[model samples]
Each structure stands twice: as structure tokens, then as C-alpha cells.
Target: MNRLFDIFRNKYFLSTAAFAVWMLFFDKNDMLSQYEYRTEVHKLQQEKDFYEIETAKVKKDLNELNTNLNTAEKFAREKYFMKKDNEDVFVIIREDAKD
Candidate 1:
């Protein structure tokens, strides 16, 4: 008990404990702020990873469209509903289909 009380009474120990408490709870960038920052970084990293995958898919599509005339035409017809001047475009929609 005496040793514990002496340890607590030491000025250096008290100052160090006070500093740790301040840094953990009262400083400009505290524990909560650090956690929030880390969470935000994680979320941004996920978003970046998702976008990179999407970008790769888009780039692959673009390359295919550039290299193959048939693929380009298919993409245009499917995405834009494009047709030749004399061709008829028929769109079939199922009643049970969902958007």
C-alpha cells in the first residue's frame, strides 16, 4: 500500500499519467478522432478498390469494342438500341422481369 501510494505521489509518474489521459481524451486528435479517421480511410479504400475493378471492366469492354467490329455493333445495339435505317428493332419485355 505504501509503495503504491509512493508511486502515485511521484511527480514524474503523475505527469506521465496526466499526459496519457490528455492525449487519449482531450487533445486535438484524440482516440475517438483517430478511430473515426481510420474508419473513413477504410471506407475510402473499399470505394477505391471497387472503382478500380469497375475501371478494369470498362477498359476491357473498351478494348473489345475497339478491336472487334461485331462486338462494337452488339454493344451499340444492346446499350443504345441502335439500328440500321431499313432494319426494324423489336424490344421484348417480360411481365415477370424486374428492373
Candidate 2:
């Protein structure tokens, strides 16, 4: 018991222990801050991955559109309501569908 008390009473040990406790709990960049930073980094990585996947899909679609005249025409007709001369287009809408 006396040996333990003597170790605790040493100035160097006391100061080092106090500093460690303060740094772990009360510093500006503490354990909680580190955890939050890791969480934010993970979220940004997920967003980057999602954007990369979407970019790949768009690139594939663009490549197909540039390579095929039929695909280009189909995309134009479906996406932009484009039609050739003397063509009638009918758009069907469901009343219960959400926009």
C-alpha cells in the first residue's frame, strides 16, 4: 500500500497521468472528436462511391448513345418527346401516380 501511494505521489508520474487524462477527455481534439471525424470521413467515402457508380453508368449510357444511331433516336424519343414528321405521339398519364 505504501509503495502504491509513493508511486502516485511522485511528481513526474502525477503530471504525466494528469496530462494523459486531460488530453483524452478535455482537449480540443479528444476521443469524441476523433470518432466524429471518422464518421464524417466514412460518410464522404460512401458519397464518393455512389457518385463514382453513377458516373460509370452515365458514361456507359453515353458510350452506347454515341455508338448506336438507334439508341440515340430511342433516347431522344423517350426523354425529350422528339418525333419525326407526320408522327402522332400519345402520352399516357396515371392519375394516382406520384410525381
lDDT leader: 1
Indicate the worst ten consecutive residues by lDDT in candidate 2: 90-99
Encode model 2's per-residue lDDT on 8-81: one tens digit a residue.
99999999999999999999998999999999999999999999999999999899999999999999998889
C-alpha lDDT (0 to 100) for residue 91 of candidate 1: 92
Tens-place lDDT per residue, model 1, 11-97, is: 999999999999999999999999999999999999999999999999999999999999999999998999999999999877875
Instruction: Please report the candidate that would top TM-score against the real structure.
Output: 1
The global C-alpha lDDT for each of the candidates, from Candidate 1 onward, is 0.98, 0.96
lDDT of 1 at 93: 75
